[model samples]
Target: MFDKIYDVIVVGAGHAGGEAAAAAANMGSSTLLITMNLQNIGQMSCNPAMGGIAKGQIVREIDALGGYSGIISDETAIQFKMLNKSKGPAMWSPRVQSDRMRFSEEWRLKLERTPNLDFYQEMVGGIVVEDGKIVGVKTSLGLTARGKTVVLTNGTFLNGLIHIGDKQFGGGRAGERASTGITKELTDLGFETGRMKTGTPPRVDGRSLDFSKMEVQPGDVDPEKFSYSSSTKPLTKQRDCHLSYTSPQVHEMLKEGFDRSPMFNGSIKSIGPRYCPSIEDKINRFADKDRHQLFVEPEGWNTVEYYINGFSTSLPEDIQFRALREVAGFEQVKFFRPGYAIEYDYFPPTQLKHTLETKLVSGLFFAGQINGTTGYEEAASQGLMAGINAALLVQEKDPFILKRNEAYIGVLVDDLITKGTEEPYRMFTSRAEYRTLLRQDNADFRLTPKGYDLGLASEERLREMEIKQKKSDAFVGFFTNTSVPPEVLNPILESKDSALVTQSDKMIRPFSRPNITMDDMRKIETVEAFIRENELDTEVLQQAEIQIKYAGYIEKEKNNAEKLNRLEGIKIPENFDYTRLKSLSYEATEKLSKIRPVTVSQASRISGVSPNDISVLLVYMGR
Candidate 1:
């Protein structure tokens, strides 16, 4: 088995590794996925949900690019909801409550069924890099497998140390052993590594919780899915999540355990996610607050285990039990397991190129928590890109790169590579300068064709995207040309508290009005007739409506993006001496020299590179 060399070897089968392996295999690479345990592939180690806020946009982009996350997420979804619907279209993201066990099982099955992909259950001890290019990986059992390219997506398992109060154990997650040797080997090979901490909340017995005291959070009335393919559908039934809160008394009880907490006591020096901190951290930081919200989510449809969403802590077991029981719904809570903070080694992402391939180690890639990113969607997107680029390199094809304006995935990669996160990087809509152009509704329109061109996306996927785009464009054109009589439109406008038209007006005018929705527009006789005549689906109608409604904003963002793309085209030569440019700031010269940004726009985004420095470089380049 070690004799024949594979094209791409992915070590780790978490979200990132799963997507990476699937994408590489699907793209025609003879891929091998090595993991410590086969059954735990695609484990929702932290949360049983996928997508939220800006994260949902990422999942859609993955689907558009023909990645399996969306397909698997949609198929195993227990509930689905489109988050931030009350906000603008750019803010809208699809989130789902997944059956945790099924989510993992689905991913395993999908990867197993994928041609050109093979799985082996073992701990990859270290990678084999000869003269800075990946050759293969060495397993803990002293076996070796040869590969041309290797992607390390080892998520939170590299020398993982789990903490529960003052007690620490060698584990990546509950019931999972920590992976060893890779970190030490990589560091010895000149890789910079730092420790990062992330914690998950306790899983309580659902049968012991009091539902009457909690607020029920239900799925959307019309839930959508993550996958663009027709292979999966939105869930018809949903297991609702319940909202509870921690009171002052709960905080007081938790405070007693703070002295023993690894976070406050200095037992753990690594940084955790700032946005999603542990409950103890929350209470300590927000000391004046009387209460903090908590969401109790079920682990699976067939199980009684419920995950405490916002109550993550590494507090002692006795303290965790005492404090949790003070909450409304968890008055008689029975623990399935206690929450723990795990400190694991991660490589700062700036060491990698835009393709997620390491600059230091050619043909070697990094993804997931190993890259210091937090969240399944972010990890999955990175994995997909790394896999795509690895396969492309093997095929001797051009590397696939997404610009900041092209996608949220583009923004994510650019941020990681350009900025180099000291803390865990999570995607948010505010992080994207061109969020208006990266809406969840049009990921397929933005990227499926590109995916198809690379042979990652299927012909059927591209055809479906093309048809949707064509129909939606025609529908928008129809609205632009069609008009409605005052008798047919004025009443509907009046009901929405929008200004009523005195005379006949273009249907697009009223439809574009604030508070006037696609549903409201559907009431118009002419609009409904045109829709029925065109045989448009909900997705098409929504797309057309958003285009019509935010046309000016969309055009403005496009113009801004075009400006950025111009700078993106201005390349900086490799080994370019920044010190030679006397006009450049000392800080800028040092950073630019170190990062060696591929493009001027990328250099312009570096932390210390001022506008004057960019001008200096542009002048030096004779731009």
Candidate 2:
């Protein structure tokens, strides 16, 4: 029995739950983390990797905002890569393949070490609600634990149904029991719920595969980590992942089990991730293609288990193994288990505010898969924000909300609350309009101060951010003021195939040329001497160079963001009756009423709300 009322009660122990508990407790709130099994605290259920494309930017943002995901990822990474290195700095993303067991172990250890946090092993069957407000949780053991606020991060567990071939069972994950009561309880309490499906590739024994026929995909020569904190060690030695393909014969073998496949046989009705489709779905959709690529990834540093990426299916075990044998490297592969698909319950996110708290229920919040989000990074970021807001609500402080131009976290939350995802939502670089200003390299600059003010991010992080800011500004100022003679700079520019300067000019003028880099500038004795005198680190130098090179585009984006921010500043009353406005279109009124957008900017983003409607509303508000 629990006596003392906790400030926060976090349900589930996946990425979202872990972060929620850590954040709330670290911010001086008493938090309780209830999970069915603590062993799977931060288990990489889908893949043993973290960060890819825009997802990497989100992890860095999470770290910059004092979240533990990046630090845990770096500490356990077996391979490191900076994706999109050939592209602009805004596109560069840091990713790492983690040791599965170590990733979970590190998360559990970190949680145990956190202050004002306690852990319990139990299935949270229902919540204790009183007058539209959450007061506590009731476990399967018939015991009740009291809390001031509750955060539900029950990832893919509520009323979960797992499908393998024609066989169907109720389970949250592989070999895990399904969670019950909470979904029904919430639905009864006037919440709208829907179903979503996600799957994973089969785990295979690494020794059974033949690497000689596959192409090696090694980690970057100069590995970068996810966390900026000193707690994580840099990766020096990295394991290699292999690339293989499934031929037409393999596709035919997989198709043979189409009759028994859960996805095609109508056993699973929920929508899976659009971007990451199943193998059968891929083959069915792209019938003209002959081969599909698969990445053979290791599970950990010590384990013999390997994840068969891009081979996700819900076909029969025999069909899965038979088809896998036809692949290049998996000629004699052995499977640890057959891949399966699971459909779980999720609530429509439109019912929630940007703070992730339900409009129908006070002192309660939803995050992660429960909010219809798919990736670990997305879930972790939501958990971080939800946890911070939950703590702030208890302490009688304003809710912490980030703007779209400020961080990727802001863009994600805004997109969710405004547009409401139909399928599982995943992050992409294209989603953030202000991507240049929201680059991973400058996450600390954009968010560390806010995190520090929230009492979650340490003073040390703020200090590091301040130092980097000063050094980068000084480096940029030096380039603007310092002039280099043609004799000294022309040779370096010519070597880079850039036009030679005709006269002594400002160093920044020549540095702006395409293919020219800070390293090229450093070849000049004066620039080199200036860099030496400043003692600028690689990060600072990179920041300064990007600023000078992309100054025009950056300034343009800033102006656009500022203009849009004015609309965001125009607050809409929470109880505004959109139906009363006869001038607004019926569809716009319906959507606006349902979404109940908190700002004019959010209303403008809704699908049915037109630009004209925004103009009308602006005029009506006397703007």
TM-scores, all models, native as reference: 0.99, 0.99
lDDT of 1 by residue, 151-184 (tens): 9999999999999999999988899999999998
lDDT of 2 by residue, 527-558 (tens): 77877898887788889999999999899999
For each candidate, what is the lDDT? 0.92, 0.93
Mark the regions of model 2 whose C-alpha exceeds 4 Å error after superposition. none
Candidate 1 has a TM-score of 0.99
Work out how many backbone clashes candidate 1 has.
0
Model 1: residue 385 alpha-carbon error in angstroms = 0.4
